[model samples]
Target chain A: MNKQPEKYQVFEKENEILRHSKDVLASPELLSAQAWQQEYERLAQSYAQLLGEVKLLTSVSDRLQNKLNKANENIARKNEELTQTLEMLTRERIGKRATTIVLILAAFFFIVSELVIDPQLQQSAKIFGASGLIVLKVTVAIALKPIEMILENLLLKTAVRKKMS
Target chain B: MENFFLEETSKTPKLSFDVSTGKFLMSGRSIPENSIEFYKPLFEWLDEYVKKPCPKTTFDIKLEYFNTSSSKCLVEIFRRLEKIKDAEIVINWFYEEDDEDMQESGEDFRELIDIPIVMHMIAN
Candidate 1:
């Protein structure tokens, strides 16, 4: 009996078939007519079974591949969603910090204007009216929004750069 | 006979075969680098078990995914189990509700193996 390569054999039955085929090929005249017919029938049966097994394996393997592909897609989508959410949260946090910083600066300017600038203006012969002082405070208040926006954008860019690095 | 057990890993499934209860389970994913090497002991254990199998044997298989080589090993496992003519063997094939591929794979195994295979849907 010729020893077939183990790597090429999927099952013992397949190995047996290969051995039988080798033996028949080596001595074709030794097999009687009935034995030859029996061998043919057995080969046919094994072929049918092998064909069925191959079909089933192919179908199952294809399905598994599809499943894995879908799972990979799902993971990618979820990762994208998580990254977006984190970015939104980071933006919100930076925006709040910027707003708080602007508010504190605004308060300091108000106090300095009340204590120092107001007395200077009161003594200066009223070159500018009280409404001018009101307009100055209003302008500072109006600048607060843009200042906060600039600070938020700067912080966000820094954060993105740090992450990339 | 002693029970055969293997812990589940990232790339392989969990395998547990109890001799006392005749309950076998293979769960999780099976995409090992070498499936035959991984499943060799289980096949040997089954070969010994069939000789003195319990009156009623039940095998529960709940695999989310398996590679082509692993599928061939699975077929070999089922064929070995089909040899237990003296015992009442049943295979419970579990699949996730949304996993039509797994369900159909189980159905395909049912068509090939003689042992009674019952399809079960795991609720999402």
Candidate 2:
């Protein structure tokens, strides 16, 4: 890893201390115990500063890890939900199928009654009058969607019975 | 039976299931009030197609949104395709970048179906 700028500053300070070694060791009288104690204190302070920076970086790293964990957890939860939803959908076609069967069958029944069954009945009742055709048309119109829905329910019941067997 | 093709609408997806090249595709929104009714023709066509399938059938699916009812129909479509024994059924599910829901939906579908499904991410 690349050296941090603060670490580089510490290295420069150490190099400066090495350069002044002659002064430091030359005369104990000029550079006495008091001066030596001051040099020791400066090095100690630098070490403490470096320790603080390390602690800060480690804390930031920990926070990022926590965020990553939370994101992963959210994704896992969503996946579970999706699985459950898919299973439900895969099993739900019967209900929709019943509705579709009704719609198409209803349309078919309507057309047959109007064009086939009703006309035949109308022809048989021609002696009564053309009013029979009008009545048949009215009844077919009133029962169109409802009768289809009823037939659809019947079909659904039969399907359920078959499946149970 | 002739190949099926239904144009996309605001409430439904575009459906084009051809037989010549064996390319089945459905794209866009699918929120029809009666999804089963809308998909009835597709099922009828597939029933015929599976009888004499092509070497490789690629089903491309790209849906921006779909309702719960449509989900069931889609499942039915996949189940129908699963009956084919010869043709290689490949499903390609496409989604825009950062669309996690769509991607996961595709994942869910692939898990339930026997066919191979590949997910593709496009630019958002």
Q: lDDT tens digits, residues A1-165, model 1?
A: 556454333466677897888889799999999999999999998898788788889999888778779889999999999999999999999898888988898899889978988688676537777787678768878988999899999999998999899
At residue A79, give the lDDT of candidate 2. Answer: 100
Model 1, residue pairs in steric clash = none
**For all the predictions, what are the DockQ values?**
0.53, 0.01
lDDT of 2 by residue, A45-111 (tens): 6566445434533443444455468779999999999988865664466556766776787788888
Distance from true location, Cα of A16 in model 1, Å = 4.8
Looking at model 2, residue B21 earns an lDDT score of 88
Provide the lDDT at B61 for model 1. 97
TM-score of each: 0.84, 0.43
Maximum-DockQ candidate: 1
Off by over 4 Å in 1: A1-16, A123-125, B19-21
Tens-digit lDDT track for model 1 on B1-58?
8999999999999999999999999999999877777888888899999999999999
Model 2 chain B lowest lDDT segment of ten: B67-76
